[model samples]
Target: MQETLTRLTFPLSTTSAPCSEEEFVARFNQRPGKEARMGYDCPLCRNKEFVLRVENGFHRPYACRCVTIRQNLTRLRNRGLLELYERCTFENYHVTEEWQRGARDCALSFQKSPLDGWFFISGPSGCGKTHLCTAIASQLILSGHDVQIHRWVEWAAQAKAAVTDSGAYAALVQPLKDCEVLYLDDFLKVQHGTRPTAADIRLAFEVLDTRYNTPDKPVLLSSELSLRQIAALDEALAGRIAERSRNHAVQIGSAPGRNYRFK
Candidate 1:
């Protein structure tokens, strides 16, 4: 009777503690953002990943303009596509040569397409390959696709370094193989503009083959080498990329005029 009376008088709470802001934002990054979900990452107000301003001198329980950039930064950090992310857009790509106009048009078309095939662009240095690739990635991101820009030269080195450990290697390479869209920047590029090594071929094949086999996975490849050049080095790998991108490939000629840095 005494125990029953105590239980009745002071019942345990049924509800859990409210979720923390950090925890909530982490979850939010992984899904489509909640509408009207307003917060900030200012350490002055709180730990920062996003919001930069408080509205009307009130704490940031309300949305502000900086949230968009904040959200973009958070998203880019979450994805592997961090560099050139803030600025790359269709509007930013300059149209100089007739080929540039064509390239821009091709990029826009790829951005607007159903995204069933790969996008391959090859050009000499300074042809804006990375810029165009990033522009496409930015658009896909806004559409809520999980996109990553794999800086092939740098990312490949990282993949090579991680090979010392099996789990670490997989963790590094897994995203390249599985992301919704992958922008492979500077594909098969090497120091002194030399051809890729055998190790490079193996690594490239591992990631490209997996994506190649999956018909629905869309890949964007930008290389200093043309498809013909890549095919010369490794036809099997180049064949997969070429076959997938046959519908949307752009190859800029290696004219001194094609390189804008000369001017």
Candidate 2:
């Protein structure tokens, strides 16, 4: 492995410059193994020594490429993919000491098992529920999981539009059904005539039903609605969600001097 990596170099002069002893010495000196191996003996490449076989092929008599490639792949999987996480910051997301500890614990637990569980974060506006939920989603994505975020009103509008168009409905449903993590922010923000429309209730139920039925894979939800409020929207859907969800909830207190908004 050492010899192969050391021997690897960029061609300096292309075919214009013929190999010379001085050039060879200079290039060899620049190589990684030259200085160390010149004085020490390599047991693996010594006379009568046995060579190991790798998945690619038998190791070279003095150098192995397989080990280098394996190391590179392992490093890439760990560090390279971590860079893909999408981070968002908001001025109102004040992480209290207690919440910070909880967040750390939550992150560690997710890193370990990464189970498909539901999370409901309910709080008045400007309480940082959305910020924290998105932070969690970003962390999960960095760990090589798929995550999707949607505003409650926007999602309702889209789903409503989809009801009249089969293709549109499928497009919306597939991601909601398949994503590793799905975040629904500002739940219950969609307006209806005095109560949630039958279609709205049905759409919500369909999503919850799919997740509830799939035991191996579950969905996560972040909503501004309290349990009681949610139950009021659709009792049957609420019951189904309660039955399958892991029952994680976060409630942030409204900050002082900040007005709360309800829809």
Each candidate's lDDT (Cα)?
Answer: 0.71, 0.53
User: What residue pairs clash in candidate 1, if any at all?
Assistant: 41-48
Query: Over the stretch 100-132, how does candidate 1's per-residue lDDT look in tens digits?
Result: 888888778888883768999988777788888
lDDT, candidate 2, 95-131, per-residue tens: 5566544533443344345464665656666555666
Clashing pairs in 2: 1-64
Cα error, candidate 2, residue 11 (Å):
29
Best by lDDT: 1
Can you tell me which runs of candidate 2 are displaced by over 4 Å? 1-93, 97-112, 191-195, 253-263
User: RMSD in Å for candidate 1, one decimal?
Assistant: 11.3
The alpha-carbon lDDT assigned to residue 30 of candidate 2 equals 37
